[model samples]
Target: MSQSRSRVIKVHANDNVAIVVEQGGLAEGTTLDDGLVLTGAIPQGHKVALTDIRVDDPIVRYGEVIGTAVVAISRGEHVDETKVRLPQAPTLSDLPLAIRPVPEVEALEGYTFEGFRNPDGSVGTKNVLGITTSVQCVAGTVDYVVQRIKRELLPRYPNVDDVVGLNHTYGCGVAINAPAAIVPIRTLKNIALNPNFGDEVMVIGLGCEKLQPSTLLDDRPVKIYENTEAADPDANVLSLQDESFQGFGEMVEGIMAMAERHLERLNRRQRETCPASELVVGMQCGGSDAFSGVTANPAVGFATDLIVRAGGSVMFSEVTEVRDAIHLLTPRAVDESVGKALIREMEWYDRYLEQGQADRSANPSPGNKRGGLSNVVEKALGSVIKSGNSPIVDVIGPGERVRKRGLTFAATPASDFVCGTLQAAAGMNLQVFTTGRGTPYGLPMIPVIKVSTNSTLGQRWHDIIDLDAGRIASGEATIEDIGWELFHMILDVASGRKQVAADKLGIHNDLVLFNPAPIT
Candidate 1:
């Protein structure tokens, strides 16, 4: 790989294109480290052809075919999706399985963080009581009650962190009993059990909603069923539509009463020293540009290896984003079963998209195109790097809990909010989000560490981005250096010794559930 102040980075020996790293891009006739002169103006974070290319030629980057050129192109000309046609998606059948031996990762023991121990033997990075809502009908009332709790009750609970409304847009006016309903049902259940909530689960419901409060809490570790004949009569739940509730005041009072009980239980909890093995982190990227693969993501990949070596779990999702490179990942599976599982997910998503009369080509949003990503294939090459080189130990469906350690492929949509929600359901206590175009996205229940892919975005959104991964592209820091920095930063954030940018600014996006079922 060659990079210099001329600001062009050649990623691999076989790559026919390189990324322009200059802040404002280079003008025509600019010289690169290899003495290759630009034939025309090339925008920063965009690709430049390293050699002359003819029609139908492969445009290679990161040692893989990103796309095919549609027209003849001379050396040093700007190469983008306009000139490149999307290639065929990789076939899933007969993929290589468990062929790549797992590299020996030196065990990095003795790394610990301060966290709350739960009754289920899981560790929590944050201590708080989560009040879950069973239906959208109760969201407004629940939000009002949550604010009251923060003002009137939270002050008295010294040890507990702030309470969050486990609010989402599901539970009513849908195919509640359809086969696909299982996804949303399990997702909601798992989210209520997220490690950060400390198991003090409470529920707010409207009596007439299809998703009853009892349905959400029945037989769970922390049950709070509504007062109904089918539910535990003594089980405590706040139902706004209950016959006993005559007015808004009465409803809010009931919710506040329930909030105090859960808060009191949460207040007694304290942080204890725990090993890094207890950490379950979610890795994702949004608003991606070409530099994503070249800088931030590669650095995140290195950190992913560190986390895996430390015996922690890291989940990388976004099915559509990785579909094009599905064959590349199956070989890294820990065994044949895992490899088959990976293929099962890819095939399932393919069918799902087909049912909707669409395909992976719909990816690479306008922002991605403007940022220089040519197609889903190019994006997939960069997207998979965040998983590092770790063996794929397990693969789970959307909203399912991830049980094994190492890198797990949790299948979900590529939308930032939906993917984060599914990861949260999978029990991710901390999240790392990388971006080149920049987004102030975050979650209320977890700490989101944002990394910028280029220096321009880093300097422009200094307050929002927690890490400047762009340093790798600028030649100021190595990928390993940034990786170690992020690893330690996770420890500090998890231990409560420091706060990520999102937490400091109190920025959070709503949990948007993924429901493939039809609306009633």
Candidate 2:
């Protein structure tokens, strides 16, 4: 018999199981708080049954039913996917609509950050010139032009933070007229209008692409134009196939000329004092483990509440991750309309998955299971906590701009890259991403603050992680401590006084549009 002391973490008072906190695992016959003994060896992060459960009984965590037992589970035995069956999805029609009252939050006063004030009353943490492209065909040429702008022109603009080509795989070889095509097209347009870009819209286009530059910016606002007849005097367009440019040299020159003008405008902007309310923060999780809900996520939730209290905006996305626990959200909607809107997005996604012949089970990847999440139900319960207890002020579809402040549920795919890009399109000026297995995910246009879910991952990837939320799991810090730290960190990043790990290492993932349309 082994004499090792092991401890378990119970998430809720009603939970019949608790997580094994011991490193590696606990062997059989291990003694517990009440003289109960482990019936078998349980792996770290895995659940240990605290009471006998009959077949078909509900498995509870976070005070909610995560799943139902598929087999009889006895005390001290391990509980995992093999022993549980996922429950059915919540029905949309009968979901409570805005039953919960809005949280009474005090206006946070005297909180300020140094930021670049935009002409549209927005604020930017960084002053970067974004070069938007109409289609994928011109990406190479646009990239080349960006390089030249950086080497030959960027140095002259000392105030400009950076110049990046907002290049993406869209605009060609697709059904541009299709109803769903509007999603990606609108996404590109909105990304160009992101606050960090400072309202300077410059478009590079392949003259033959289905998405013409004119169509992309048909009625959008702009800041740079050479003619009075232009719809947007502030926006400039460069068509590679224009008759004025006969050769590659002339094409490059034309792009360079337009770039110089924008760079000059961007360089003239300076950081000014802005309120915390000007901040729009995006919250997400990836590479999640069992400790995710127990540690990092709850910390993020606390921070989300702090942001809401400060009168700032916070967006929590990943539709599939929220689908199962959506019942927990409808009642929190600000009103009946907001609750219905939430249902519409969920129902739409259900049809989307059915069309693809998949379901929520397709979620909870192998890594999640290995990390002790049995199915989508468990993952979702953990995922939704990042939104905290804030009321759902609004719900927006993919790529749609956020209209209301407070907590907004921006519907998006769970894929890290795609969700990050969509959040940017939705006007996220900063991002907080928590991970367990770890991902070096970041966006060039915004600061991404990485939070680790466990101390082991935090220490191993110390250089890349901005905050070690693992302290909550290790008992070194309280959730409130990490939450306050994160809140302060957001202000520091917004003020440009600190740089996130992703930005320091120059690790940026490409923009991946959530195009649900077919390519014809």
Candidate 3:
């Protein structure tokens, strides 16, 4: 690459380093547009120092001090993880509260999609028959019965989308009475009631687990059915250990019979045109790279703001991802109380990580480093852009249902599966997942739209990636261009007009619970 043609991206005027934008990276000794020669081969997405740096000097990116120089560095040198030192996380005390002025955007109206309207006043993008399991002991049985139900019963019910077994690891041998147990417990209960399931709640239990099937529905208003007729909620549970079951055949038969009832009810559901306000969208990112912040995330953030303006609900989670960037969020809270709620979840996760002897630095997986992220600070700064600039109207603890509209910070683990599970439990009917390194992650109950950060990954994983924001980096499109494209894509997917790549490829990850409580 020559000095006149070599391209790099500098996010802020104060940023002393910029990412290499050349395909396959620039070779050693190649001169940048500014005439600074590369001291070594800089990989694509990797940072290049713009000036000489002494030991202990701060390395700035995104106009934030992501890390400090551990050793003396010269101008034009490749700035990789080994050259930088992780900085201390910001103290969560007396941070600004609801001080940022909200952008004066006109309300977006008349956007609508075809969705299943549940009796509980919730809208479902897909009508699925969800089979809830009480314990891990029944997971195999549920899986077996689910396959049978799909093969035998699903074909008869054309309106129902699919059957999903809600399998998890937290049921028996755990300290159910512990305070932390509420997370997984409520997560299971709420997932069973997700709008996508059409409020058809059914539980398959081992009969004697510490977490009883009935206990899962306590204090919750659930309408379970028997053969298309509303049955006693208490009678919705099918126990494998019951004396009525003669053998494995009988057990499977009994589960099929119960599932058929839910399928019958779900089959009766028809798509109705609902306003966009009924949409509950979850925003997440994984397998991220430097281009993630520059392209995909910012585009998703723009779409998030559009959703908020349209009176829809949007949630951005991953506690540790937001912890280091909490200062930027707290002031965006709609009120002081919402700001305090955000801090409360952060403090709770801090103690939880402390108990596990882990810290925020454990984030930004190896793939992230290979993609140009040095530490969690840089990752957090990039990660939070998915939330957009909307004032966060509410903050909810893990597993709790979303109670307010607009952008809500639903505190959850950064693990992709766990975050997806919790967001579903929080009533997310559709999800938008951004990736730079690329992932084929999907959920059985909801549609997941995968966005790629670069055109290279989009081309490599052509069928798996739904949209490519990399055009923004290549100057073929702008962030607003991709944002509007994603916004319309969301409506189309929500209306069942299109299928996401993950769904078409039949790729779905299992639900993993965040069990902070003790197991026996």
Candidate 3 Cα misplacement greater than 4 A, ranges: 1-4, 220-235
TM-score of each: 0.97, 0.95, 0.97
Which model, 1 or 2, shows the larger TM-score? Answer: 1
Give the alpha-carbon lDDT of every model: 0.89, 0.88, 0.90
Taking the tens digit of each residue's C-alpha lDDT, what string does model 1 give over 123-196? Answer: 88888778889998888888898899999999999998888998988989989999889899889989998999
Q: Which of the predicted structures, 1 or 2, would earn the higher lDDT when compared with the native?
A: 1
> Which clashing pairs does model 3 show?
none
lDDT of 3 by residue, 1-520 (tens): 1112586888887788888877798899998767899999999889999999899999998889999999988999999999989998888888999988887999999999999999999999999999999999999999988998889889999999899999999889999999989999999999987899998888888978999888788876443333223334345678888776778887887788788767878899999999999999999999999888889999999999999999999999999998888888999989999999999999999999999999777998999999998889899999999999999999999999999889999999999999999999999999999998988899999999999998889889999999999888888899999999999999999999999988888899999998999998
Candidate 3 or 2, higher TM-score: 3
- Please give, for residues 1-520, the per-residue lDDT of candidate 2 as tens digits: 0112365778888888787767677899898876768899888778888899999999998888988999999988999889989999989889999999887877677788899999989889999989999899999998898899889999999998888998888998999998888789888888887899998889888879989887768687433333222334245887788776668888887778787878888988999999888889999999998889988899999999988888899999999999999999999999999999999999999998999999788989998887788899899999999999999999999999989889999999999999999999999899999998888998999999999988878999999999998888767888899999999999999999999999899998889998999988
CA shift at 87, candidate 1, in angstroms?
0.3
Point to the candidate with the largest lDDT. 3
Q: What overall lDDT, based on C-alpha atoms, would model 2 receive against the true structure?
A: 0.88
The full ranking of all candidates by lDDT, starting with the best, is: 3, 1, 2
